[model samples]
Target: MNTIVSTYNLSKYFNGICRVNEVNLTVYEGDIYGFLGPNGAGKSTTLKMLLGLIKPTKGNMVIFSKNFNKNRQLILSQTGSLIESPSYYEHLTGLENMRILQRLRNVSNKKVQEALHIVRLEKQQNKLVKHYSLGMKQRLGIAMALINFPKLLILDEPTNGLDPNGIREIRELIKSLPQRYGITVLISTHLLSEIEQIATSVGIINDGNLLFQGSMEQLKAKNKAYISIKTQDNNLAKKILLTEGYKFKQNNDRLIFEDLTDSHIAYLNKLFIGQSIDVIRIEEHRKSLEDIFLELTGKERSL
Candidate 1:
């Protein structure tokens, strides 16, 4: 895959401390690259460096194959972004806000209208931004980001202040960008579940370090596999599984085997049937991205 964005040994300093240390990133065309980390994990700092809003202390950053530091105008023309909260004139209507951005980007009013349609904010185009809910404001932010029809869109926590419906809307909007508009996206957020649903690839960062970078499927596959089996005699099945030397976990009435193969499962089913133990259900339990992240990061998260 050809890289649309690449960073080499990128480092940023704040008060002589490395905020983002020796990082490398690759974002390909037509990819929604999820950049995920906890709060204060240097996500914003790295984005600023990439956008040339802040100068890097060491290493190089390139966008669209151009060094952002040297070709700032060229990069800006091809890219659109919403970093942090997008602020608009409190008194301005949604249309007005988009018009201002379009003017600045040297784009047409039709482009602004198209962007509003993309974010599903066309009906609220005449409403004052102050009257818009947080979710609406986020949609407007995305509208502004799309006003230029940029080849690459950088969104920092695109669903930060959205409600469930708004989050769903944004997720659909992001997913449609590559196919509908031929736009690639690089989105930064701490919401792993959201990333799992929308991103084609992900880069996990923590404590200013890039821990892992790969597809969500690849990350999920890194964790151990487990086979879940439900039987009439839950306790007896658990006992049999343990006695048979299968490493397992108990989920409600189900006994899950950590390393059980198809043949092993079949054998267990036959044994249970012979013993008059009804086999209720059986399946391979696939680990989620969150499960893999917990194992890799060694951190516990509560719902």
Candidate 2:
């Protein structure tokens, strides 16, 4: 796949305070790249620089394999974005809003219809914006961004204020875009679950630093599977294991260990049973994406 967007040592500052430190982002064609971080982790700042909404303090940005600064018009023409909350005339119908954007973008009525259809908003296109639900309004924003049929779509926290149903709707929409429209998507969010659902690639950031970037599979491969042992007599079990020279991690109520086979589990179970320790449960667990995100970003969150 071709590189659609990239940054070299991208940095941003506000009032001499660093909002985004030296960071590099690479987005490939037809990929749903999730830009994930905690709140105020420079996810939005990095995206703003990519869209030229804000100027970078330093570093270079490249999109469509062309320098952003050198080919600003050409690059922006093929890029669409909906940042934070989209502003609209509440009195106007969704179609009317799209018509206004159509005139501005110099696109035809067919394109407007197509955009609405892409966002699954055709049925509600004639409804007044004020009468629409939050999710509908958000889809409308996405439709407006799609009016020009951009090859790359940038969305900042698209599911920010959405309910579960709305988030699911948007997630399905985003997941479909790559295969449906051949458009590469760059979506920024603080939720790992959101990315796990829609993104093919990921970039994790924290405290103005880019902590990790890779395919979703690569990131998930870091999730280790371990065996957890819960017993009625955990203290006695711990002692028996320590005496037998076993390595493990202990939580409040369970004993956790890794790199063991089913045979080992059987052996341990047998041993514990023989020693009069009642084995309540023995389960294998895999760390979730959220767990890995917390580990990478540090256990203590910003807020």
Candidate 3:
């Protein structure tokens, strides 16, 4: 796949404090690359630098295989972005707002309707921006970004303020872009579940530092699976597990084992039965994306 966006040792500083440090990011064509991190982890700062909204303190970036420093205009022409909340003329109708952007971008007027249709806002194009609901406004913002039919779309927290249905709608739209329009998407968010659903690849950052970057499958492979077991006699179960030298941890009223085979489970069941200890429950537990995200970033608070 073609490399759509690439950064090398990308760093940003504010008031002599490094907000982004030695970060390396690669986004390939046709990929929905999820840029993930906790709050104040430089996700937004790095995205701003990528969009040429702010200059990096050190290192450089390349977009569409062109050096950002030298070909900023050329690169930006093919890139469309929405950072934070979108700005709009409250008095203008959706169509009117699109017309303004069309004029500024020097693109054909037909693109206005096309963008509106893509965002499912064509029916509401005649409505004033101020009257639009939060979800409608967000779709309008995306329509504005799509008016140019950009090759790469960068959205920072696109679903930030959306309700569950709105989030689902946006996620579906974003997931469809690569297949329907052949557009590469780079989305930044603190939500791990959202990334797990739509992103082809992900980069995790924390405290201005990059922690993990790879395909979702690779990240999941790093997480160990465990089995939770509950027995009628917890004391006897513990003694049996200890006698067998099995590695496990006690959580509340259950014992968890990281490495347990089907045969091992069977043997344990038989052993318990022979000893007249009832086995109440036994189940395997796999780590979720949120679990891995929290562990990798070493943060207790939710994203």
The numbered model that scores best in TM-score is 3
Clashing pairs in 2: none
Model 3 lDDT per residue over 1-303, tens place: 899999999999999999999999999999999999888899999999998889899998988889999999999989899999887898999999999999999989788888999999989999999999999999999999998999999999999989999999999999999999999999999888899899999999999999999887888888788899899998998998899888889999898988799999899889988899999999899977777888889875344
Worst 10 residues of 2 by lDDT: 294-303
lDDT of 1 by residue, 1-303 (tens): 678999999998889887898999999999999998877778989998888789899999888888878898999888889999887887999999888887788898789889999989999999999999998898898888889899999999888867889899899999999989989999998888888899998998877888898887777668677888888888887677678776777877778677777888899999888778899999886766787777666664322
RMSD of each: 4.2, 2.8, 2.4
lDDT of model 3 at position 300: 58
lDDT minimum window of 10 residues, candidate 1: 294-303
- Model 3 clash pairs are none
**Candidate 2 segments exceeding 4 Å error:** 230-255, 271-281, 299-303
TM-score, ranked from best to worst = 3, 2, 1
By lDDT, the best candidate is 2
Query: How many clashing residue pairs, candidate 2?
Result: 0
| Regions of candidate 1 where Cα sits further than 4 Å from its true position | 227-259, 265-286, 300-303
Ranking according to lDDT, highest score first: 2, 3, 1
Q: How many residue pairs clash in each candidate?
A: 0, 0, 0
Winner on lDDT between 1 and 3 is 3
- Give the poorly placed runs of model 3, Cα more than 4 Å off: 230-255, 275-281, 300-303
Cα lDDT tens digits, model 2, 1-303, are 799998999999999999999999999999999999999899988988998989999999999999999999999999999999877899999999999988888999899999999889999998999999999999999999889989999999999889999999999999988898888999999888899888999999998999999999999999989999999999999999999888999987989998988888999999999998899999999988878899999844332
- Error (Å) of candidate 2 at residue 10 is 0.5
